[model samples]
Target: MRTALRRRLLPAAAVFLLAALPACSSSSSDSGSGSGSDAAKATESGWSFTDDLGKTVKLDKAPTRIAGVNDQIVPLMNYGLEPVASWGYSSIKDDARFDDLDTSGVKQVGTAYGEIDLEELAAQRPDVIVSEVYPTDEKGTIDESQPDYGFKDLDQQKQIEAIAPVITIKLGGDGADVVERTTEFAEALGADAKTVAEAKERYETASAALTKAAKDNPVTVTSLYADTDGVSVAKAEDDPALNLYAGLGVKFFEPKPKGYYWGNYSWENAGQIGGDMWLLQQAGYDTAQLKKQPTVADDAALAAGQVHPWVSAALDYVSQADYMEQLAGWITDTKPLDD
Candidate 1:
């Protein structure tokens, strides 16, 4: 889930019409009838990408001065493409997902999603902006009328699109959705093929490991932002990684997305949420901190220490593999706390 500040702890991003996307892409899937965009193609004359909205973006040369949302930028960096500027939700600054990657020289134009220092982004002079698209409803529909997942709206999208072409990568069903699409885009942008290939190999291994662990364990999990006041449980349908994890046979607690991206519950009532295990934020909200909550002392998962950190990594095979590897360990080791 793209955590948002709807409550106090979670963070969300800015979206736009002509927006941004992620990096590290392989060959694009052949366009199905009515898919609305052509497959991304590169040639000596120029480069072109069919963005998430089915818009084909053409440029005279592959863009080097890349700038866009941090979620995507980090993956591009994994593939050896450095972005000039990046803006998005607060996750860029403090999330564990971006912990190891050094974003030293990259200009931060936005601290919160949708909020950006236009002048600061403009100062970087990016050649292209990349962002993502998300589903609007439960059925995984990518409505073009909805704003792209990195900028605020059509107005904000146009304001930035005036600076350069915006390439959007949609957050799709499985972990590989954005990773594969980003690989195609990154390759088009001249990312190293060897590095991308190696990353893909690691990803395949981790994915297999996760599948085996999940199939063997059969433990249901719940992912949430557990705060002092309440918990905001993530809706798997809204998170690309969780969707992938589910496909691998991880049984996530099915919560109706009643709020923005999750279902809300008070700390007093949090224990009522059912799951064999819990996927939680890594730091600050530790067992000690959670014990401060009313029901944490009695919660089965908490008592059993059946909690693991949640990771929404950069949509690249490298990062995805790392997270999946970690997740597989947790699943393989954890005993079910619930029936």
Candidate 2:
């Protein structure tokens, strides 16, 4: 298996960073100005900034049009930017909440690993395109034999740049922490601080509740994904979804060998394992079907209700604040979901 170490860079990580990585470069597309005083103007809404890739990108002035592929759709919606096109065809049901935002209507792009219907995307004339690209074994071929979310390189970001200014968010890493990244998107969109502040408050409130719960009754959380082998458990140390539970002070099942790649294990043997909460991070399958395996078993989580499915709309950005709220709500019974 290829090493999974590099996939941890989260989009929010950029907030804590200003230095560019060797593989990435600031966009040279927008050469507006770079002076201290000019920097202020450049950051203003509608202005463009050169990204680390050197691409001159014009931030959406009235950014009414957008295109998001894969999980990128969630962050776009989290920042209140509805896309004109989405690439998750089979997972469209997974995005009902986001669809509700722009009830006007949107075009369904394509999603063969986010291959996308470039013609359709181009037709939309989006001001921004958000995508995650991982290095594949061949230039155009995507290796399905891999485990890490398929984001192996920044080439996809570069490709999107040809369409529009693209901002690549890192998928792995403790940096950015979700809320920070959401804030950055909000900042990019010139979204009102009220939205950002409310998200922050929700996260803080949720995190506090989870912390209290953890002190008295810490729970272990695990995120399982379907792999070619069988049921594959992504180590908590690197999986962002599981990382939330860890941050909330809950005990997470850390595998003996931890890395970004999915660890293989039989579903029939899942019952031998124990966790206070079994979070089903269903990328594209029914949890009921997964539970039927011999290794897995019916439980209180599914019965009395401890099994929490990651709500796509609820934790849209997985922003730090969003993480806090998600962890809090998932663990605490203090308030209703609307609360």
Best by TM-score: 1
TM-score per candidate, in order?
0.82, 0.67
Q: Give the Å shift of residue 114 in candidate 1.
A: 2.2
Candidate 2 lDDT by residue in tens digits, 198-287: 756666676677678776655566555543345555565554545565666866655444334455565545554445555665453356
Candidate 2 runs further than 4 Å off: 1-46, 50-64, 89-100, 103-105, 133-160, 226-228, 257-261, 267-272, 284-291, 298-306, 311-339
- In angstroms, what RMSD does candidate 1 have relative to the true structure? 5.7
Q: Where is the poorest 10-residue window by lDDT in model 2? A: 9-18
Highest lDDT model number: 1
Error of 2 at 192 (Å): 1.8
lDDT of each: 0.72, 0.49
